[model samples]
Target: MRQLFGFLLLFATAAPLSAAEIHDDIDADTGWQVITAQAGQTKIRVVPAAGFNVFSIEHAGRELLKTPPALADLPGVSYGVPLLYPSPNRVRNAQFTFDGKTYHFDANDGTNFIHGLVHNVPWTVRRTEVDAHQAVIEAELVFAPGTKHYAAFPLEHTLRVTVTVRPEGVSWKYEVDNTHGKSKVPFGFALHPWILYQGERKNTFLTIPATQWMEAENLLPTGKLVDLEGTPFDARAAKSLEGFVIDDVYSGMQSDHPTVADFRDEGIQLSLDASDDFTHLVVYTPENKNWFCVENQTCSTDAHNLYQQGLKAESHLLVAEPGETLSGTVNYRIRDARGHKFSRWEKAIRKFEAQDRQHPPAAGGTLFVGSSSIRFWDLPKYFPDRPVVNHGFGGSQMIDSLYFADRIVLPYQPRTIVVYAGDNDIAGGQSPETVAKDFQRFARKIHAALPETKIVYIAIKPSLRRWNLYEQMAKANDLIAAFAETDERITYADIATPMLNEQGTPKPELFIKDGLHLSPAGYELWTSVIEPLLPRAN
Candidate 1:
């Protein structure tokens, strides 16, 4: 039986996989296919289908991964690609012992047992025809007590795997039943798939609405939860996965249905909707690898230990009674954004514009908008003698100021407008020309609406840190000053000039540890610059 299983594995690994035989049902109520393979410039595409949306995983015009096409193909390999599993990388030891029994498993990374045994093993496939456009594949794997390497598990179980492929995307369903009469079983399971052929690493992004992350000690979960706020663990934004080496588990994920792992450059997006059972996700990106893995899981890596420690919740565990079964599903889709970029600036701009239209800026109060440096400023206390309205948001750019001008600048309708912005624009990748143009547009709009309001443009400060961009910032300040000079109502305030050291750069005393932002001394310098310009108190 062992020899037969070995022969079956060899055949499964070496069988000829047909790419051409894969039929395309484009008109069968499934969504549009956004090809990303060599033909599509590796972008994502989204199509709407009947009863569901079809998302295809493509790079250029080549298809890399898709849902199984039939119920009979339940564990079917994608284009005969090796179904990469357990954990893609090294597992510390090729054996994990539990309940006084040691189980020795196959090792791939010299240290870790990977992808579990199910991935490389072949299963009997039974296909069911559902019209010409749809089909279902059902595959089953039964493990008897004391079967070769699985002897440590010592429990009879039947695992049924189902795959449904339509024109839109693929859906996978797994049902596990304990056949051991009156005997309880202890086991852990996970699904692993490696997505490869991704284009430029810097251009690819992974987003998961996760609130907490699990820190690892040598790739083993530590059973501790860490907040995602203010850390690189936060993938709320589609940040570049380049230079990131992540092999961590994340729990407490936002219950947002259908979480997405979008790879725009590859024109592929893998979505997991295990909202009912799989609440945790593990994202793995090894340095210099061509692919990444987004594994939907019910628990962490060391779930058994976690459960023993009372760190695992009941929702994360899969327990079965006599004749009881556990089942769940994961769906994958593909989409293309057509080069449309996603940024915090764009969202902030849209929100500001909406608020501006609803409650236009008061026309003249001082507008202090920029990065964290500006937001930290206590406007009311700083300018107590003057009637000032604060419109400052931390970590904002000049473009944000322009987009949110009505909310931050124009609403106060004061006699003068003091503008403090631009630092974050430079950090956010805007050139001096871009920053100047945005500022110019904002000033023109304000002036057009309130001709009598005086415009005061504050100079972008040089931070003791982030000196690399100092020259470009200086150039930006110069352009702003030149632009302000073109109008009678516009005035330039050179706060940066006085704050600089004898060497004509920021002094360390004026900055915080990050160096890009300011210290109390920095705010004091700003106060000195504005104190003389404020109008007398009433």
Candidate 2:
């Protein structure tokens, strides 16, 4: 079932979770520590002592980060995310040979040592700072001389972690300073964030842009890398998260763009972005559990072992020399994707709502609404006599207006709604019939709320550049005009006819240089036709 935590949620910090207010404190135990930061509505909690993990990420009023309600129930299970280093995933027999020295470790995972040793130890808080736009915290955990953790590997080094939260998303940086005078340390760094879900897993969709899968046995790599062809790990695009119980490592990440893994269920969506340095990704879906992990690793599991065995040309181990720093950054963007026809426009919706708050328009007016064409329209200039409220957001689709209707439209209680969308929707791959149906649904919705109010749907005009979709546009306009005829309150404002020339071809004078949007004279022509339908002043 869907759950709501305390009212003090992180929904504001939820999406594009980036910011600049940093706060530092220690856990009640004192052995653990915490750093809380805020950026706009985005709020983030970084627990440095508890493996340098993010304890909470709240936005608006919802906590997007997942955690075990209790930490004591399962041994070695990280309720929060865990920062790992030096052979990240698994080491065979908890041992590896480095420069003739066979270093051994305690097998924490039955026969393998997973997630590294520093994840359980305390990290000293180095610094904390905040600016107007972002908040950052820096902490370090050093491998002390003669300590058991060091003695097992006997490497003198310090691993520093810095996490910055912003209104857009949270970014993390990991830097390892090799203090050894002569020896170059070979190590792996990784993060295991347990992003969980509520309700049905079948409803949720997952996306990870990876190209290869690491062939492993018993969670340990067998020094073989293979393509993701016909395998269950092929998540090149967004697909279902159910049916395939995955605990696998994938490599060959898409370097041209920021590596992203998107998770969406019901109305909520979360996207994880990583630096180009994060070439390897580990997708861990525990058996019969609600939580899943999309981990970013510097190298494949047992990188040191793979490098020692000479099976692969490069094992991705950051062989840092003395006094060198190896670092990376990762960001998390959470959003509520309910209103959008497509999932990716969550940011645009948030921006629109924010814009409304910043510039509150007067209600009970003739509201002009739609995509960019309507957004860029000079509403007041044309309809000077009438009280006008323009709620045209970004390049919005007809469905987008529907999704955000409650917040953008109905609240205003407008006597008339003039819409000019559907141009971009068809370009975005929707059929002409779909756009017309969406308009019909939109009219029905408006009539349901305000039966006396009028709804004027502007016929999609032909653009010289978008002449290819003009046929589809004409078909959609025909359908909308027909539907408008069914209701006395509905009015179809046909602008397409005036824009067509003697040969029924588009007039270049109607559009701007881009041939997509309207020009001043174009609005003049629009005013000439649409002016007749608009209610006149008393």
Q: Pick the candidate with the highest TM-score.
A: 2
lDDT of 1 by residue, 133-195 (tens): 444545566667645424534556766666565433555677777655354444444545556
Q: How big is the positional error of residue 437 in model 2, measured in Å on the Cα after superposition?
A: 24
Candidate 1: deviation at residue 207, Å?
Answer: 0.5
Candidate 2: worst 10 consecutive residues by lDDT?
A: 1-10
Quantify all predictions' global Cα lDDT against the true fold: 0.57, 0.72
Clash count of each predicted structure: 47, 34
Alpha-carbon deviation at 282 in model 2, angstroms? 1.1
Return model 1's CA RMSD, one decimal: 20.1
lDDT of candidate 2 over 269-375, digit per residue (tens): 77776777777888887667877888888788888889888754336767788877677777677654543443355565567567656665555568888888887
TM-score of candidate 1 versus the correct structure, residues matched by position: 0.47
